[model samples]
Target: MRELELKYGCNPNQKPARIYMDEGELPITVLNGKPGYINFMDALNSWQLVKALKKATGLPAAASFKHVSPAGAALGTPLTEVEKQIYFADGFDTSPIACAYIKARGADRLCSYGDWAALSDVCDEATARFLAMEVSDGIIAPGYTDEALAILKTKKKGNYNVVQIDPNYEPAPIETRHIYGITFQQGYNNFEINESLLDNIVTENKELPEAARHDLLLALLTLKYTQSNSVCYVKNGQTIGVGAGQQSRIHCTRLAGSKADNWMLRQHPKVLGLQFVDNIRRPNRDNAIDVYISDEYEDVLAEGVWQETFKVKPEPLTREEKKAWIAQMHGVSVGSDAFFPFGDNVERARKSGVEYIAQPGGSIRDDNVIETCNKYGIVMAFTGMRLFHH
Candidate 1:
């Protein structure tokens, strides 16, 4: 098709929206519902992210996108028993593509409430089954298996958006856009991220094992597609935390670090043992868990929100217990969209168990930043490339 119409633009009042190709026919086909302007924006950006991740790691990849940023991204990796439980993958040791989807969805469930999903490879029945259960807007991929297509057709009462893009399609080197009756042009930011970028170790501890390198690469790839003033924390082939569109670098660091810490805190013994009512919904459980992890639980519990979700009222997770559990978290990798002008970012990242970092090293206080990493025995690299996406 040459063009596709939309219900509206980004908002309800922004009327008369459509997407068309300026050169030739559009390369995307919608197999299901009509997608809006923001849906297309998220679909296209997330498609590029998973495509690059698959090429870099040679593994199937997936991303869960909300707004224009990714809530989470992951490569094909087997899920442990604990992971299966937390990701609602019980009783299904699904395919590799399915595993990737679960990890992507589990990154930050709260943010992915109505997300657009992207896959590196073809969608299969295993993956489709997982997606069918979530609260999502649509999905985009290269292709879909017959069984998967049949299953996805049942979601949202057959109105869910399903898109298929040309996997080999490439855009022009120079891109253009118009804003407020003015034209703007720039070269595409297609700089490749690979092992070579991880070669420049700038910390006292120069050891970056293969697994750490994979995590660093994953973080960088995620940051490349994220909004500017972003930071990502990745571990075990998946993104644990992503802070996007913040105005300050320190705020980004702290936001991502706190999410990373919460990811680990969920695995703590006290958290794992929390019992819910026999028929508590997944979304409700997710909300309860978030409140239970945060320090505000003492106040929330007093407000009587806990009694509705749990079988028996559970004690709040204490600050001491949370701190002790967080201390045990290590081997996490963090990536920044631009330079860290101060060592305070490193100090906060250390509190969340960050042991490896990747950021453009252009700050005037680079020495102090390196010194902070040295104090924590962290390994850091200067990629010399800034990834600032709008």
Candidate 2:
């Protein structure tokens, strides 16, 4: 097909929306429901991320996307017992692609609610069964097995968007878009991310473990597709936190660091031990956990409301306890879409247990940033390639 029409644009009021290719037939085929403009936006952007991840790691990959940015992304990695419990991934099919998607969605359950999913490998029955239970809008991949297609067809009362793309289809060298009757064009970003990017280690501490290198590559590739002024924190082949589209670079560091801390805090003993009442909805459970971890636990634990969700009103986790637990988190890797103009970003990242970092490294304050990394004994690299996606 040369074109595919949409019900509406980004919003209901916006009209006359469709996607097409000028030179040839469109590369995607809508296997199921009609996807709106935003759904397609998330699907296409997320597909690129997972595609890069699989190419870099030689493993199945997946992403959970809300809006155009990814909530999380991950490669196929074995999950620990604690991870499965917190993610509610029990009884899952546990295939490689399913594991990747589960870890991606579980990275930030609150943010991933009602997200669009993207997968590197063809959708299998195991992956579809996992997607079936989540609150998601749609999915995109190269293909899907017949059994997987059957399972996905039942999602969202059979209105779920399922898309298949030509894995070999390549876009033109230049891309274009329009805004307010003005047209803009630019060459597509085709710079590759790989282990060689880490060869330019600039920190005094040069100990980049194999696993840390893997994570740093993951972080860089994730930031490549993320919106500009972004930061990504990754560990063990999964993105635990992503701060995208911030105007200030330091804000990106702080925002992504706080999210990384929250990911670690969720694995705390108190959080893992919380007991919820029977029949609690998934979103509600997520909210309860979030409120319980926040400084103001009273919002969810007020005298009359605590009993509604929890079996026993658990004692509030204190700030001291949170800080102590966060300090225990270690070996995290971080990446930035642009240069860090100051050393403050390093300070903020270190607080979230960052030990390795990757960035373009062309700032005037590169010395200060390296000094701060030395103080924390953190390893950092300069890729000499900026990744500023909009």
Candidate 3:
């Protein structure tokens, strides 16, 4: 079918919504529920992200997307025992793709609520089962196994959006969009992110390890699809934090760095040992944990609100403890859609244990930025390519 009508556009009043191909049949089939305009937007953009990730890493990849930006993305790296526990995936046989989704969603659980999921490989039963347990709006993949499809079809009262795209389908080189009755066109961003782009080390410390190269590649690819003025922090094989659509470059860095700090704090012994009342929902637990880690935990404790989520009055994760915990984070890789204009971005990133960086390197204050990285012994690369997405 060339055209698929939608219930509405981005909003209920934006009527007469649909997606269609101008020349050929559409590449996707809606195997389950009808997806709206925003859902399809998230699905298509997220699909491209995972596709590029798998091609670059030679592993299965997954992404969690919200409002056309990725909340998290990752390759299929094996989960450690601590990772499995923190991600709430304690027991169950899992496949590579399943592990990818788990890590992707776990990167920022609060942001991934009601997210759209995308996978580089076909959906297997294990992956579907894991997806079923999450709070998600829909999913898109090349294909699905029978058991996987059956399980997904049962979610959201059989109204979950399940999209299947042809793996071989490719769009034209030129892409177009419209806003306010005007047309805007551009060549699709086909820039491939790999180790080659990260070879231009400009910092005093020029040592870039193989693992750091992979993480930098992951960060850059994620930023490519992220909204402009964005920064991403990646470690191991997954994105730990992504700050998208910020106006200032420093704000982006600080926002993403704080998120990275939160991701690290979740693994702290204190956070991991928080006792909750029996049968508390995952979302509630997530919110409670977030509050517990923030500075407002003392206020929550004083207000006696902790009784609703935790079994006992938990000790506040003091400011000193959080600082000490974040200091231990290291080898983090950060990528920017554009250049950093000041050294403050570097200062904030270093607090979150960022030791490697990649940016376009066109700012007037490049000397200052490089000097800041040198002081911290951070290795930075000037990719000289801007990756701004809307």
Candidate 4:
């Protein structure tokens, strides 16, 4: 089929929606539910992200997307015991693709609620079982095993969106879109992120360790698909935080840094030991955990609202305790879609244990940025390639 009609556009009132290819048959086959415009948007963008991640790392990759930006992305890496607990995958028989998706969704559980999932590898029974437990709108992958397809077909009362795309399909070099009756076109962004981009070290601390290089590459590759004015914080093989579509660069850094802090705080011993009522759902637990880690925990306690979420009156994670815990966070890597105009971005990033940075490096305040990185013994690289996605 060359075109597929939709129930509606982004909004319900925006009628007469559909997707089509002018030159040839559409590359995707909808094997399950009918996906709306926004669902397809999320699916296609997220598919590109996972494909790039798998190509760069030579591992199964996955992404959770919302509003056309990735809430989380990850490569298939063995999950530690702690990771399994935090991701709520403790007893599941997780395959590599399952682990990748779990890590991606766990990066920011709050943001990934009702997200669209994408996978670089074909979906298998293990992956489908994991996806069945989550609150998601749809999924896109190259293919799915029979058992996997059967399992996914049962989700959302047989209305879950399952899409299969041809792995060999490639779009034209030039891409075009229309907004408000006007047309816009641009050459596709095909910049490959790899170790070569990390060579231009300008900070006093020029140590880009092998692990840091991998994380830097992960961050940069994520930024390549992220909306403009974006910053991503990554560690190990997954993104911990992503701040996208901000008007100010410093805000992006601060937003992403705070998210990174939250990810770290979740692993705190106090957070790990929190007791909840027997039947609280995962989403509620995530929200309660967020409140527990924030400064408002005392307020929650004072308001007598902790009883609804926790089994006992939990001790507030005091600001001092949070600070002490956060201080131990290290080896984080961060990437920016554009140049930093000031040093404040770096300053904010340092608070979240960011030790390595990558950016396009064309700002007039490059000296100040480097100075701030040096102050914290942080290593930075100027990849000289800006990644601005719409």
By lDDT, the best candidate is: 3
lDDT for each candidate structure: 0.92, 0.92, 0.94, 0.93
Worst ten-residue run, lDDT, model 3?
A: 85-94
Write the residue-wise lDDT of candidate 3 on 1-390 in tens digits: 999999999999999999999989999999999899999999999999999999898989999999899999999989999899888998856899999999999999999999999999999999999889889999999999999999999999999999999988899999999999999999988888888899899999999998888899889999988988899999999999999999998889988998899999999999999999999998899899999999999998999999899898998899999999999999999999999999999999998999999998999999999999999999999999999999
Residue-by-residue lDDT tens digits, candidate 2, 19-127: 9889899989999989999999999999999999899989899999998998999989888898898888887878889899999999999999999999999999989
In candidate 3, position 206 carries an lDDT of 95
Model 1 vs. true fold: TM: 0.98
Residue 246 lDDT (model 4): 97
Model 2 whole-model lDDT (C-alpha atoms) = 0.92
For residues 22-138, write the lDDT of model 1, one tens digit per residue. 787888999988888999999999999999999999999999999999999999899988889788789874888889889998988888888999999999999998899888999
Angstrom error of the Cα, residue 4, model 3: value is 0.3
**CA-RMSD of model 2:** 1.0
- For all candidates, what are the clash counts? 0, 0, 0, 0
Candidate 3: count of backbone clashes, pairs at least 3 residues apart or interchain: 0
